[model samples]
Target: MWSWVAHRITGFAIFFFLLVHVLDTSLVRVAPETYNAVIGTYKNPIMGIGEAGLVAAIVFHAFNGLRIVLIDFWAKGVKYQKRMFWIVLALFVVTMAGFLPRHLMHVFGGN
Candidate 1:
């Protein structure tokens, strides 16, 4: 139940992120200066953190979506759904653990 809810929520979040990405990228064609300004603003610490969050969302969504696929297609998918869910979570944590430190260093570490 929770996994289903989370998948839906993450899907929506990803869809919205893509929508915004397209809009921002489109600005380059309509107004080059505005696009430059917008891109420049995204280089700061706050946006860096936001990038990390977006990455986290993408990672979790990808792993969970795969789990859902296995559940739907595999012969014993139903029987092992719970275990797959745990594996999905463990993978998420491991991925984030590996990603966050390097990302934070790049974000906060002075160039």
Candidate 2:
């Protein structure tokens, strides 16, 4: 049940980010300077948090998604579903540990 809920939330989050990304990229075609400025806004701390959230959503979605696929294709995965859940959680922690610092720098004027 948790997996299902996480999957749905992450999917929606990713979709939202994708839409925003596409719109931002489209701005480049309209005006390069404007696009750059918009991207520059990402340096803001608030936007930095959004970026981190995006990363978390993607990572959780992918890991849980792989678990789902494994279950769909093989019976063994069902037996170890709880184990896989912990694996996903561990990976998420490790990924965020690596990602957060760099993201903070990017947001706090590291560029």
Candidate that scores best on TM-score: 2
For candidate 2, the lDDT comes to 0.89
Among all windows of 10 consecutive residues in model 1, the one with the lowest summed lDDT is: 36-45
Q: What CA root-mean-square deviation does each model show from the true structure?
A: 1.6, 1.2
TM-score of each: 0.88, 0.92
Cα lDDT tens digits, model 2, 2-100, are 989999999998998899899988998988899999988876888889889899999999999998998888779899998999999999899889988
lDDT of 2 at 15: 98
lDDT string for model 1 (1-111, tens) is 998898888888989989989988888997889999887876799999998988888888999999989999999999999999999999999999999999999888988
Candidate 2, TM-score vs. the true structure?
Answer: 0.92
Please report how far candidate 2 places residue 81 from its true position, in Å. Answer: 0.8
lDDT of candidate 2 at residue 7, scale 0 to 100? 98
lDDT of each: 0.91, 0.89
